[model samples]
Target chain A: MVDVVKFSGEKEKFNPNKILKTLKRAGASREQSRRILKDVESSLKDGITTKEILDRVFSGLRETPGIAAKYDLKRALMALGPGGYTFEKYFAEVLKHYGYEVKINQLIKGKRIMQEVDVVAKKDSTYMVECKYYNYPGNYASTKEAMYTYARFLDTNSRMHNFDFPWLATNTKCSWSAIEYSKGVGLKITSWKYPAKESLQRLVEAKKLYPVTVLKTASKFVKQRLLDSGIIMINTLMEMDISELRRKANLSESELKKAILEARQISV
Target chain B: MVDVVKFSGEKEKFNPNKILKTLKRAGASREQSRRILKDVESSLKDGITTKEILDRVFSGLRETPGIAAKYDLKRALMALGPGGYTFEKYFAEVLKHYGYEVKINQLIKGKRIMQEVDVVAKKDSTYMVECKYYNYPGNYASTKEAMYTYARFLDTNSRMHNFDFPWLATNTKCSWSAIEYSKGVGLKITSWKYPAKESLQRLVEAKKLYPVTVLKTASKFVKQRLLDSGIIMINTLMEMDISELRRKANLSESELKKAILEARQISV
Candidate 1:
């Protein structure tokens, strides 16, 4: 056992089984999981940060883009931001996956003025989701954001008589006051680490509804091309014919083959 | 007569009387105002912007920094920003002048968190104001800001219970949605041009409650020194004897004399 430091600077006894669990969960065989865990444990140093340990896993599994890319859920979201996943589109698809009828950039007439809603989702009741995407992490969706979204919900619902509630969804954490005020006002909020049961990270992991860019085998250019071709979700890419995929995304045979293999590993 | 284009791009025939009104208001004699206006009209080209005409006035009256500085209220506010008139303090004084017993940066314990209310004021009812100051203009206080302020107002009001209502005071114009939402939520908002009768600009001009930095004769260095010494208002300078003011602000005899002259012009 080795003592390791966490990102929050807390020291913890390093658990080798944690690595094995992660590997196996990402589709590695039992033997392969043990082999990777052994490799990671051998190089692990006492007092190394958890982040460094995770980086070792990433390096150990670099050849396996599907598993490696999934290691950092937060980074994967940030990658989705700049690497052309179009956070709004990805969010809309996530809503769709969860059995919600979703529409993006809906223009609704309000009592005071016209309003543009980021994502309109409906299940038993209609929800107006305001997506706040920060390309970089460390930004908090503050009380201001929650209240603004709620106010818009009030304004829109008053005129259209459509939305039943307001949901503020951001790819970051929420300030304490934001959470408190949001709950107080009946506004639903989901972020990287709120609503413990179903945060943005949890939603993606629960369904493996990762964006195609999450496949590290897909270069920025290929990811953008795929996104441009309307193959946003990994499952969407999984359904494409290899020849059609190559032609549509302008991918070479090798690139297409590697992307498909990685997609399979994650999709499985 | 030359047509002058306004800041909003509207064309209007140049009216010498506007300049005359501004000069007379700022303490320039009518004869001096006409002398300056004659010079401005001679050089005035067809389709000159109102801003350029104002610049001409600034140049014409540059020797009289006190009166010249007061010519453009908006620009003077902007000057107070980078030139070092602490906006929160200035806002507090403005509130004080309006008969609100004001405190800057009042810390109140809220149900959620420790709230730092900017410019807490008490008149008939206690008003919690949040000051939004953009060093440069063109930034509008959006609906998000209004909503955020209101939420804080609600949270702070809950525990402290000392405050009766919320007020949003910004140095710039507000978005249409922001105004509508703020009013609908029962939040009092005063910005550059909200509340037609009692806007921020109107309040500042209603009384000659100009910040000391509005004295164009005071260099940025001089203005900063004066502010550091707690001489924020022009009236404060008026009340101080020459010897006491010099000792307090470390001003050279010439600098002190010029500042006092300009203060007298504006104050009288």
Candidate 2:
């Protein structure tokens, strides 16, 4: 057994089962998951840092053709970042692909005051989505965010013609109390791996609308450029030819080809 | 001479001097301003509502060829409404016209947390301008606003590279204490006719960047449409051809002509 240096600098016995579980959760095949776990175990030294272990696992997964494309989806989502605006934009694009007419950063006129809505989506009825992006995965959308969304909904309900649905979308999960309060107020919630069917993961998988940040092959600069151009979803890049994509995104030949391949494989 | 009802419902003596003062402030020639005031005095009736008096004056100003287009610059500015966002946008445009690169609703990362700056402007140095737009001209920006702006400045100064100037820009006057506190903290302030030379009115007149809402002839819908399309300044409307303005704003022929005439007059 190898000793793993935790983020806090504390050493702990490395658990191969944890890597296997993470690989399985990422939709890796049973055989491939076990093989990657073996690779990670072999690479781990007596006092390997947790980050090094993760790097080894990511590299080992990339070597596998079937699950390599989806290896960083969870990490990439986390990378969408310290600011909530980008997450809101990416989620708006996802909802748009799911057939909702979405407007992001909308200044909605409430009865008493003005509200800046993250994303106002319209289909059968209007849905106001509040996106909460957390840089750290451990952080959860709390009751404060839910309560604020509820207050905004109450203020804007009269202005909306159709039935107003207040929804909270977050890259991370919500606190138990937040979920309870949201349910009490009839506020819909979509967080990572929550709500089973309507979670963010499920929604993205159902529509194959992955954010550009989720591309493992793309660098931070490339992701930012794509986001700035309103190309948040991987499917948007897939719709364009390789030459056009390269030219528009200012990507090198190798970067473009790798991005397209990863996007196509993961989306499929 | 006729009687005019005040906002408090008191029957007040009709004063043509008041009208003359307003016209002169709006940059009307002395002779034309007196004539317009005389016309307003003739139109005033016994126990006339303040609204009726304003309507008559606006109508009378519209008849003048030279300054008719610039009539109601002050009133229209006040009409930018019950909300502060429009005022912020208008002031930002005014600053932009003054050669300052302006950004509205910018999230500035502070030392402790994030601060939402109403207007971040840069020329020789960075100026963070907090706009306090009160619908009722009587409502002055109080000490609370000044203190909050000063607090934000302290938090943002270390983050800015250049000399940071904290400014408070309001559509109305600041309270006495607010002025005193601002002076103590070296915070620059611009209010309606307060600073005399550097006031909001002065800035608007210097650049001739009046907001579209100042047009007494334009309907609420037309003004809102113009605002939504990022056409805040009166000069922006003047730059467009009448045909394009009518098509884009979806204005009636009369409304289009009146708006264009007023925009062209005021900008010149």
lDDT of 1 at B227: 83
* Alpha-carbon DockQ of candidate 2: 0.01
Q: What is the lDDT of residue A108 in candidate 1?
A: 88
lDDT (0-100) at residue B138 of candidate 1?
48
lDDT of 1 by residue, A221-252 (tens): 88878888877888888888988888888878
* Candidate 2 per-residue lDDT over residues A1-268, each given as its tens digit: 7788876577899888877876775678898877778887777789898788778777777755335545556667877766777788888888877789998898866654455789999988888887888876456787657655765565556636343788989888787866776665578899987898888887877776677777766788888777776677788888887777777777787887777787877766
The DockQ for candidate 1, computed on C-alphas, is: 0.34
Writing each residue's lDDT as its tens digit, candidate 2 over B107-152 gives 8765444557899889998888888888763467876576557656
- The Cα local distance difference test for each model comes to 0.79, 0.74
* Residue lDDT tens for model 1, B1-268: 7898886577899998888987886778777788899999888998999778888888888777667777766776765666323777888888888888988887888766567888888999999888888777546788778877877787787744577888988888898888877767788998987887898877877787877877876788988788888788787877788888889999887887887778778765
Scored by lDDT, the top model is: 1
The number of clashing residue pairs in each candidate reads 0, 1
lDDT of 1 at A144: 75
Off by over 4 Å in 1: A1-58, A82-85, A159-162, A228-230, A241-258, B1-57, B79-85, B109-114, B159-164, B240-258
Docking class of 1: acceptable
Error of 2 at A159 (Å): 3.9
